[model samples]
Target: MSDPILRLSGVFTDIAQYHILQGVDFEVPRGQVTMLLGRNGVGKTTTLRTIMGHWRARAGQIVLDGQDIAGLPTPAISRMGVGYVPENMGIFSDLTIEENMILAASSGPIDRARLDWLFSVFPPLQTFWKGQAGNLSGGQKQMLSIARAMVEERRLYLIDEPTKGLAPAIVSTMAGALRQLKDQGASILLVEQNFSVARALGDSAVVMDDGRVVWAGAMAELANDASLQERLMGLSMEAGH
Candidate 1:
């Protein structure tokens, strides 16, 4: 197999006096989805932020492809083919949908073909092209966020909780969008709370606890064994999806 597109080795990030990410280590394989799972406050978001340089790595190396990007600025990391969709969606509420997308294009102008493809995946974007992003529903905003990331051709993407607080129907739609992204051979590192989404999209998974990975394996192995899911995630299949 080819080397991982992104590798985090003993990554440590500090926020103020608190040490948020303590020695996080994982690999995002090329052309595969790697799920990052854990309870709240387990540094999952911090890991993604660290990779995007939102939070600087106080220690450890963040290797992208064959280059170390540990301390590079967020823009620098983004220019190197890594895209990040933050938890907040990060869309400018005041901007129109078209304006938001135009700003997201880091590589010259947005490709007309790619824009058309995105419209196919998310038709609402076209419908609301002139409307302010803040006027969009939560699900539409989520789609816009992911779409903005896709606007540029990126090698790897770090997405934080795309399904959080979404209705079941919206979740299903987001799932389909993610499946299309995967089918197109995009590499993704996702931090999701929904096990169903994780299992459906992940090729491999790493579970973090208190800023460290406690479990790492195939998503199928974790999905098939309810006992393992309970032991690691502290939730039964019946409790929630």
Candidate 2:
């Protein structure tokens, strides 16, 4: 059975005076990736922020493994084992790469085997471990952001636009690393603008428009249906652009 690791029911979130998410609902099944897709400004990032407790839900349920965590503090939610990589690649520019990783190991020490695997997937983290994070290139910053999330094993990962603005080769490398993460049974909820990456990794998908789930189905089904893709994605599928 495909049990949900996380579920949101009729979630409504506000940003200042503006309401960003109106009754957003979805489930991230255990041990699989669920792509959250839509054109720009469709509440995708807001949904993620709400889940991570960076933004408060105005109404409805944000359930994690059957626990209602709608109004919990961000640190409390994080302690419950939800890892997040924000759209801006939330890394401390002033900190060294090593210091960032050290902080991400919130539960305990970073596992040596996991650190080795992360270095293999993202060599720059090893290459520039002691360097200031602000000195890294865009792609390297993204790699460090993701590696920071994997410094500890978590119940679920909420990753936003991880492959955005990266070289094709680097995108491929990132996809490969995520593939390995999936193979190891990590559950991921990814918000990706790259259609090819979304199609490649998402087991199931949820498409949002105007702050609500407009479509939800298997990723392969969406990928094969050109007209459906046209109707749902429009010209938004930027291959890897």
Candidate 3:
């Protein structure tokens, strides 16, 4: 809505001969959590990948903090302060938890205060400080992935399905940790299927269908209208929430 940290305009991507993003467009407002919602196979993961430079956009502009980064290399984008946590929970399985966090802090050594705050939010990192990342449970690994992104400060965070396939209790934890990020003035573009989590954390909502933004408005407007949800997402849900 204001001071958008990231903007994607007319973005198109093709993997081999198959088209993925067909003129995708959206903006992530600064200091707010924008939920990227859509049914499966609508190019949500591909959109994130394109933004992070894992998949280059064939056309259009991806403006990050007033600079176009659509075709830049992944490391260049990372250096420009865009953090990504893919759906796969991108962590080195054989590395210790400490090692994973260290690798995530590419700018420099992680500050002690930031690490303390991460430990406060994700206590398991402290509990398994010496354990390999592969040894942790699925939910714990998810926590590790998010905590690694929070290891150092960044201008924007692109997170994909942080709460996927987790228990209700763990989902609550994940949402709370995200709330902490929002509270600290971080801008996040989150892809979440769990209506509960999306409703709880989103300030604005963007609904993508067939790789294009079909709906963009306040999160409350989208949350209160079940018919719109059904039309855009192909299912009605959580009427009054």
TM-scores for all predictions? 0.97, 0.96, 0.97
After superposition, the stretches of candidate 3 with alpha carbons farther than 4 Å from their true spots are 239-241
**Tens digit per residue, CA lDDT, model 3, 1-241:** 6669999999999999999899998999999999999999999999999999999999999999999998999999999998899999989999999999999999889899999988888899999999999999999999999988888888999999999999989898999999999999999999998988899899999999887889999999988888899888877658422
Q: Give candidate 1's TM-score.
A: 0.97
Would you list the C-alpha lDDT of every candidate in the order shown? 0.91, 0.92, 0.92
Q: Pick the candidate with the highest lDDT.
A: 3
What is the per-residue lDDT of model 1 for residues 14-112, given as tens digits with 9 covering 90 to 100?
999998888998888999999999889999999999999998999999999999999999999999888899999999999999999999998889999
Steric clash pairs (candidate 1): none
Q: Candidate 3 overall Cα lDDT vs. reference?
A: 0.92
Better structure of 2 and 3 per TM-score: 3
Instruction: Identify the runs in model 2 with alpha carbons over 4 angstroms from their true place.
Output: 236-241
After the best TM-score superposition of candidate 2, give how far the Cα of residue 196 lies from its true spot, in angstroms.
0.7
Model 2 residue pairs with clashes: none
